[model samples]
Target: MSPQRPTNPAMQRLVDFYDPAVMGKDVGGRTLAQILAWRDTRLESQHDYIQVLFPLPEGSIFNEYSPVVDEETFLYLRHDSNDGFKRAMRRALARMLSFYGFDITWDQDAAGKWVVAVDAKKGAEEDHFPRWVRRMDHNHLRITRILRSLRVLGLEDEARAFFAALCWTFDSYRRIGDGSMKFWRRAVELPLHIAPDGTEVDWLEKYEEKKEEKAEE
Candidate 1:
């Protein structure tokens, strides 16, 4: 039987992104799985794929062609209802995490909402940690996009969990470089709530420091 296609082009592309059996392509004409299969060097060099892998409610600052997560589509992809999307999201998350020499784990609370936990990958080459954490680059912005996308797409707990991991990296990883933390803070609470440009930092316990610090070379 042929797959049931979505009437909305954006919805159809989204289905292509997170649904494995659908062979549709993102706006860039690459499937999500194809993007995921890219090596670290390609992942590092490519600028457009991040916005597609982890879309925000608003258009991407880096990639203009990015798909925005509007309210109607956002509500339709509910965590309580859509386990397949959750699984596909997990794979996407894991792909990014592993790229940065990290491993992922998941848990469920009483309500059964899935939550993500990140850890440094064990037995990684000695240089892996430094390569991922020491430099300030596009990955930092990618982190922001990932967090907000997770939240807007009905994975709030998972977003919070990922944020907690970022908090740890900011402090412990050392040399996270300048300006990354501020961008990350902005990610959790973009001007809009979960709508296009919507972000919430209400759950964060402490306010960000007014003065920023520079990481050592």
Candidate 2:
């Protein structure tokens, strides 16, 4: 069956942008695939794409033009019925990982059950990737965005799994500091409680959150 259209026009456009089958472009007139194909320098320099790729319920602080995630869009993206969209988001996550010079792979753990791990790609250390992850840079903010985005978008398992790998990497390398890692933890564990309206309640936003609860009560 074809993907269902969304009731909200802005959300409809965002959904098409994310769903590969729909092949919709963002406000910048670039397809998601095309944006992913951009070189690392371009990826680093181009700030707006990250917001488009890993949107949140709230607007981005740095990018004024970022798309805001809406209730209808959130439901459709997170619905188990749309497995394809989830897979597409996963692929997008991997691409972002690669941009940071990390590669994700599955390997058997102690019990031989397969598990996910993120490691610096072989020879990637010769370049600036390792140093970048180590530095107190804007990359951490991007990581923050994606991690939270993955969780809110219904890939919580994948987000937790990636965090486990990151934990291991931090322990083994001792590069990324404790302060930076805290953001990662908060993003994955953020309580995106679904409100009656079918969207996540941003617990961090006291004003709006209180308003919603007051209205409900």
Candidate 3:
């Protein structure tokens, strides 16, 4: 069977998200066609590995251009029956991306549901890991600062929920068969928030610090 092509609507959406100028030029020294070729190659070679490493949820939309939740935990969240949780999740994700300096554009589909996409940054590096991960790490300390600001601005719930979702996403991606797992394992932990009162700390940081202290003793 022949490979499927993204329909006109999907291609138009991609063009809008990327904008004409950036999309017209190459990304990371490779044309869009070349990058897509590499992506297709990896998907083919790692199909089984991806399945075993991150099994698809029941009734998942896994084909081209469909949103996929690779982590079991995140899959649960995405499929959660709680409307509030889902709305909060969407808001949190948008807020998190905005905080990271990514321009998020949304458009209503035929059903009046929003389809969101992040505007592609120019001159961004596209390596083995997703460009999103690399950009997040580039502003690692600033991410923490943003969380603190959100908390101070009475948006602690948004911040917490965002970080929780991100932690799960990172945990899921880190478990995949990529050799960059170690880098993700370290990079992902950076956005963990610190309590302002000093009475509490990020759960992961506290656990890690205690482990190190125990080892040193």
Query: TM-scores of all models?
Result: 0.75, 0.79, 0.26
User: Which tens-of-lDDT digit does each residue in 1-217 have in candidate 2?
Assistant: 4445678776777888877788899888998899988988898887889998888887777988788776667667877788777767877888888877678766788999767667777776666465455847788888877887887787766678778767776787678878778878777754555321234565434543654699898
* Candidate ordering by lDDT (highest first): 2, 1, 3
lDDT against true structure, model 2: 0.75
Candidate 3 has a TM-score of 0.26
Candidate 3 on 29-76: residue-level lDDT in tens? 333333333443353343222211111122223333322222323323
Per-residue C-alpha lDDT of model 1 across residues 92-197, encoded as one tens digit per residue: 8889888877778878879997566777677554635555576577677778778878766666666776777777877875678657777667666543353323
Backbone Cα, N, C clashes tallied per candidate: 3, 0, 0
Residue pairs whose backbone atoms clash in candidate 3: none
Using lDDT as the measure, the top candidate is 2
Residues forming the 10-long window of minimal summed lDDT in candidate 2: 190-199
Off by over 4 Å in 1: 1-7, 108-115, 123-125, 189-217
| Candidate 2: residue 131 Cα off by (Å) | 5.2
| Model 1 lDDT, full chain set | 0.68
